[model samples]
Target: MKRALILAALVLGLGGAGWWYASQRDATGAEADPPTVAVTRGTVERTVLASGVIEAGTLVPVGARVSGQIETLAVELGQKVKAGDLVAVIDSLDQQNEVLKARADLAQIEAQQASNAASIREAELALDRTRQLNRTDLASTQALEAAEATLAVRQAEARALAAQRDRAQVALASAELALERTRITAPVGGTVVAIVTDEGETLNASAETPTIVKIADLERMVVKAEISEADVIRVKPGQTATLTLLGDPSTAFEATLRFVEPAPPGIAQNDAAETTEAVFFNGLLDVENPDGLLRIGMTVQVSILLERASDVLTVPSLVVSRGDGGRSTVRVWDPASRTATEREVRTGIDNAVTVEIVEGLAEGELVVAARDSDTASAAVTMRGRRSVFGF
Candidate 1:
């Protein structure tokens, strides 16, 4: 039922638009009963239009590396922060205890090494005495060998104790680093846009770093536009573009195209009853936001200028019918004779609405494009429904 009503509304809207268009074509003016416009030298531009969103060009997602309960959240959402500023603090009691334990272990190893050194000295003295006795035939060869072996063992033990102390020192340093990491600091200077975790929130960041906050440079804004595949070829980097927000269509801002994705994706637009699969290429435009009027995810209309001609003789392209080859004719109105006559003219640039007249037309000449007769007062909507807003 809902779909049927929507379809009916669309049909009615289209019919109304058609009636309104035909009526406007018949409206009478000072000279005739049809709508006519004068041929004049002016500038005409052709543009490709698209819809997009305004986003921060540089956005940082701050995350926690270690898992612990959040002890202090220093910055709130929308808070400005500088690099190295403390943003959050995690529980550090366990890490601190680990550091203390590592220190104790290192100290114990050092004491053991000292004792082993003393033992080595004592054993060396005994080996010297045994060697002297053996030289005098007072000690057996086995006694000398035993004393030498004891000294060697003591020295080996000292070396092993030194290695253990070195490893313990490294462990202590690692533990200290872990303890310092409990105090999280800002990576860059920006405004905090989001705060995912709060004080007392436990974060398990083992599998992946859990986002604590989001920071973004709001001044550097970019527009992510999706251009239809049919019109994407006309758009390229370095093209001038104009953007208008959905809410404020009258206010426009200028931008420059910076990037266009080569690999276009299939975009799926879902409706209540059907789905539309469209191929679109992604484009990026760098927009200046000094006034801060734009925001993240705000919908904007993008118009990319493809071609522009200045001081060119232009006419409504729709009324100019084309013949064989390069021949085109337009119904030029003569104000003096009050008659319409078809005149063949050379054409230049032609767009959906306007065409440039190269010859066979003069300035101040009139051509009937539509009629301003009945004034049916029907609505003049550009389309039955806008594809951008999907309504």
Candidate 2:
């Protein structure tokens, strides 16, 4: 009975081993299927990124023409103003005093001029009387000669006084003009961006350095973007662009390319060295800032649209594999057979994520992005079998 029980135990162990092997085979079969990906063919866009700053197209610098103590400031920084508006007032007391002194000097000069004129008339009358007396023989010849000499001397003195009066009048007019220029006014309709001086601050007009107040027209603006030498060739004037402000990421402003600097300003070229690097050109974009949201010196990101393709065939960038022979290839998946077939293709305008398939690819076709490890192993095994059999 013991021998029979041991033989039955060995039989049960063999059955369990066979059942475990069958289950393993079933699991292996289930794992043999290749990984699949949904292929999509759609239009792809290529964009060039460049960092820049938002700026006003027309920036006018407002400076003080005449120097004096700052008496009153009519506008503050960031205050909106109109053309011909009063911006600030220098100590008009000194200026007004200058005006008053000039006027007084002019009045004094005119009075002197009238006195000279009266002296000239009196001299003429005296000369006439002396001449009449000499003709009547009631006066000596020497006396008549003396009267003529006195008249000539008085006329010369009157002329010199008249000349001095005229000079004084000219000086007065110049002083009046200088006094009028003391009131600082805005040259353009814009906002005051900065104020350089406060009330009671003394300024020097004759100083070599000028006190400056900054102003700008916020209604219109421009972006001066520097396009890299590699991609500058694709940019041109009149091209449309979009500006994204660093301050407000949600706001996107539209602009048009107005100018491209032909030669880089203030850059020296090295011809002796063999270099692929070139100088970048400056591009200007005119933008409208109607709401006055954009300020001067605001940083921005610029995307220059060089070229656009609509409804063109495209593929994923990873699927495109470069061959050692300089040929580009992609794995086209056969849905029914669950196999990937390699095909040579030509590409154009490859962006970071997607590439434009110019030839050898069609819409609604499956392309393999990656292969499962098991599928790769199976492929290797099939290739090994073919090589061993010389098939």
The per-model lDDT (C-alpha) reads 0.85, 0.75
Tens digits of per-residue lDDT, candidate 1, 1-391, equal 9978987887787777766666544355232245678898987788999999999978999888888999999998889899899999999998899999999999999888888888999999999999999999999999999999999999889888888988999999999998988899999988899998889999897899998999888887999999987999888899999999999999999999999987654323432322256777889999988877999999999999998888988888777877888678888877677778888898887767888888999988898785322343324335444634265
Off by over 4 Å in 2: 1-43, 118-166, 209-212, 246-251, 260-282, 317-348, 357-362, 370-391
lDDT (tens digit, per residue) of candidate 2 on 1-391? 9967976776675456545444434455642333444445667767666777778766777767677887778888888888899877877676678778878877887787787778778877877887888899988788878778877887787787778778777877777777877788888888888777777888787865355576788888988888877878778888888899876878798888898887665444543432456556778888899988777788788888776666778877877887787688888888778667888998886776888888987787888766224644554454345332232
For model 2, where is the 10-residue window of minimal lDDT?
Answer: 382-391
Q: Model 1, residue 181: displacement in angstroms?
A: 1.8
- Quote the lDDT for 165 in model 2: 74
**TM-score of model 2 (CA atoms):** 0.68
Off by over 4 Å in 1: 1-35, 121-140, 264-276, 331-346, 357-391
For TM-score, the strongest prediction is 1
Q: After superposition, how far is residue 267 of candidate 1 from its true place, in Å?
A: 9.4
How far is 104's C-alpha from truth in model 2 (Å)? Answer: 2.3
